[model samples]
Target: MPYVEVLAPQVPNQRKAALAKSVTDGLMTAFGVTADTVTLYFLPISPDDYAHAGEFEPQGAGQRILLKVHAFRRTEAERRAAAIALTRGVCSAYGVPGDDVAVYFLDRDRSEVAHDSKLASD
Candidate 1:
């Protein structure tokens, strides 16, 4: 199963829901996995939850978006690309202009995450 988690400052109820649904659909299509088997998580974090560290982010606190996705079955590179693309899609869907967004992906073998615990490979 593919696990996805997204974090961003609070947005309109309808917009947030639509963004989540759009992401879920994109992942299902990109990973060639069943829609039911994917576990998508969304977390909205305020300015306190973020810290800007680069030249572009050289300013006080502001709204930001973080997206992390973990999946079994694909290589790390593949997963990362998919995650980045999804983040871009989300940015466009939400009409986020000049916003900060980041996406990351973690890959592991299917056996790593079992029903209740991490397996030996983990």
Candidate 2:
């Protein structure tokens, strides 16, 4: 399976969505699949969204993380497992510590995806 992430500082929601679409397109092109079949997850957070070192400090200097996951399963448990694995992979890939990265798995069902929409639902 292939997934992607955009780890950056706090940005506008439009930028966040655009990044999601771009990464989803990249994943589709990389995996020889259609964008409709891919689910791009954007985990946008501010410096206050998490707690660091037992204090409400910035994580990795307030680095925002976007996690994209591809999971095929018949049950919720398997889906979550795949998601967790994907999060771990993204964390490792960006050299962002697992404890520092905030993971958000955006699940886009094929039904909710539309031609002119990045995602009908978050």
lDDT of each: 0.68, 0.51
lDDT of 2 by residue, 28-105 (tens): 443455766665544555555655457676554644465545432225654455445544544544555665445454
RMSD of each: 3.9, 7.7
Per residue, candidate 1 scores C-alpha lDDT tens digits across 4-122 of 78777666878777776777777776777777877767776655555556433323255567777777767555565576668767787656643566666676676677765766355
What TM value does model 1 have? 0.73
Off by over 4 Å in 1: 54-62, 97-99, 116-122
TM-score per candidate = 0.73, 0.41
Spell out the clash pairs found in candidate 1: none
Q: lDDT of model 2 at residue 41?
A: 45
Per TM-score, the best of the predicted structures is 1
